[model samples]
Target: MEDRLLDKIAEPFNLQLPEYETLEAMIDGILPAVARFSEPNLLPEDSPLYVNSWVRMTDRPGATEVVMYRFQGYQQGEIRVVTDGEIGSKAYEVEESGDRIIVGESIMRDSFLYELSFIDDDFLILRRHGNLANIPHPYLFFCREAIGTRLTWNEALERLVDKYRNSQFPLLAVGLFVAAMIALLIYFR
Candidate 1:
């Protein structure tokens, strides 16, 4: 009976029952629910688009993992970490500071902080520290954006630049424009 039920569910996707079982197992055992729950609404509507830094420590020595963090309120705001050629479960933290901004204890010592920059109907941006300027590729830590919101990429970038003036990368604006062009090319091509 269970096999029959599984086959019925798998048929629409052209997957065998065993394949479905494997997928179900992977989703249930390995994937974190928070990450899964946060996946669907990554970007919000009319949100600004920005490029933020994402960092993760590597088992290797002296190499910090760097990834592009896209601020899209129309999509979803979940930040995912990928390391060692494997994508891990999303990071979640309980609020210790009674504020909307939250940081995990693991990174609190590094002065890591995440903020929800804007939550208006048409703009949202979550900014974080970027790669070290001097280092070619330093191990990045505590790079994340909160989930939930809708803002456009341009709007997100503007908000980030405005709020974190000190942390704004010098070439951020130019970089953003170029990146957008590249994305459009790839997307349309």
Candidate 2:
């Protein structure tokens, strides 16, 4: 059942999970990774992009559906609700069958399926699994320190995401994805 899902998700990214013959293998490989984000408090104040909280770079609405995700322990809680005067006090776990990684409690457990399909120095793409996802997209794009909570990306982030969009929109629509680590270094630097 999930193998077909993997096929659909992996094709565009040009990925193959041939090594893991069954869902259990996928779970075993991903289990240790959960330990990394399981505890965020222990991490240093300055976490590099990959290890830091990844806000949704993909368009949906509001803030990054994922307030934060940690690599190397996972955090437990709800996705943040950052408003003008509010810095959401709590922020979000990982588990379950065929899911690459599942982390957090509350809305997270049932709402998202984060399978770590691709990661480079700056790009992190999660392939969604399960029909439980409330969101519409099959893939969620995120980058560290994305300016969220507002209705839209900040001007700088908007420009950054757009550049990648413009560059790859054509390919993406046709199912050929070209990952551009849009504004990865330029915006933060």
Candidate 3:
């Protein structure tokens, strides 16, 4: 039953039992560290754009405290919030299951999958593995540089448009629009 449970947990992340075990060990060993999300351009093109955020993990006696600091925006003069919460593992082991770590808030619960894909002293990456994630790539790159950088709404929109510029969809749409305009002009002439 334990083995079956492990399999079910690892299925979504596409990790083997041994790999998950290794990941679990790695996460436990690297406690009490902060992982800030990387700058927008450095991440995958389709990755969600955050104003700036840092997740601090502190190992406790039986549970780990995960604190998140997200920069909402700079409009109202340094808008930010720090949410402190404990990491629960009763239903599934967060270190291996690659599940959403509910930090009490429903709004923030499904923001990121909260799985540690890679971790080290300098940097660590997590997979945004949740239903609400709308990224083309599921990886969330976090590093020390992502600490205090705040992104504006216009910047985020520009990044999204830039991501699709290399794709065929934008070009096709432009061509169709131009063709229709030419047809109308010729018929009127």
Candidate 4:
């Protein structure tokens, strides 16, 4: 029965038992820290203590434009957002299975800190907290196709230098001409 329960929970996110266990343990560890903010009296209907935000990044090398949501509540509560790019949607359907969990999504597993949760409806909410005291806000980035394309550092530097050179030559020439005129005026005056 426990296995089945785990399977049912893991089916949507395509998470293995061990992975889910790790996540559960992590949540348990942080629960104590957020307990103070979870008080029913503290949360207001109109201005609930928790705030949700979204973030999408583009124009990075070897990365795709992604839309992610974040929720901030307690000072120590954590959330994670997982996407199809890193973990294919076939494994985890955000629309269908994401509503089952109560927390945020687990996007990437980098060294950077993240807030992870699985909503009841199966949509994952990944919250990233910038400041402890400040209410968390979502950051969304929509990049053009040009911004999505990857450019090597060398190529980018070369392009930048080319542009700088093209734009700077005219300004430099104008400056020199102005200086020459000033010199001539001084010589004659």
Which prediction has the highest TM-score against the true structure? 2
Q: Which candidate would rank higher by lDDT, 2 or 4?
A: 2
Stretches of candidate 3 above 4 Å error?
A: 1-110, 130-134, 145-189
Tens digits of per-residue lDDT for model 1 on 15-126?
2222222212322222232222121222423323324433321234444444333332222233444454465433233233312232332434433444342332222323
Candidate 2 TM-score to native: 0.35
Give all candidates' CA lDDT scores. Answer: 0.34, 0.42, 0.36, 0.33
- Candidate 3 global lDDT: 0.36
> Which window of 10 residues has the lowest lDDT sum in candidate 4?
89-98
- How well is each residue in 1-189 modelled by candidate 2, as lDDT tens digits? 447755775564452333443323343444343323322322232324225555555343443454544443333334453433355533324443323545334443345546654443343455666663554555554455544333232332333333343343355554432123224434656
Model 1 TM-score relative to the real fold: 0.22
What ranges in model 4 sit over 4 Å off? Answer: 1-50, 65-67, 85-189
Clashes of each: 31, 12, 0, 34
lDDT of 4: 0.33
Q: What is the per-residue lDDT of model 4 for residues 9-29, given as tens digits with 9 covering 90 to 100?
A: 435334222222232233333
Enumerate residue pairs that collide in model 3. Answer: none
Q: Which candidate is the best by lDDT?
A: 2
1 against 4, candidate with superior TM-score: 1
* Residue 123 accuracy (lDDT) in model 1: 28
Q: What is the Å distance of residue 173 in model 1 from its true position?
A: 21
User: Comparing 1 and 3 by TM-score, which wins?
Assistant: 3
Error at 167, model 2, angstroms: 17
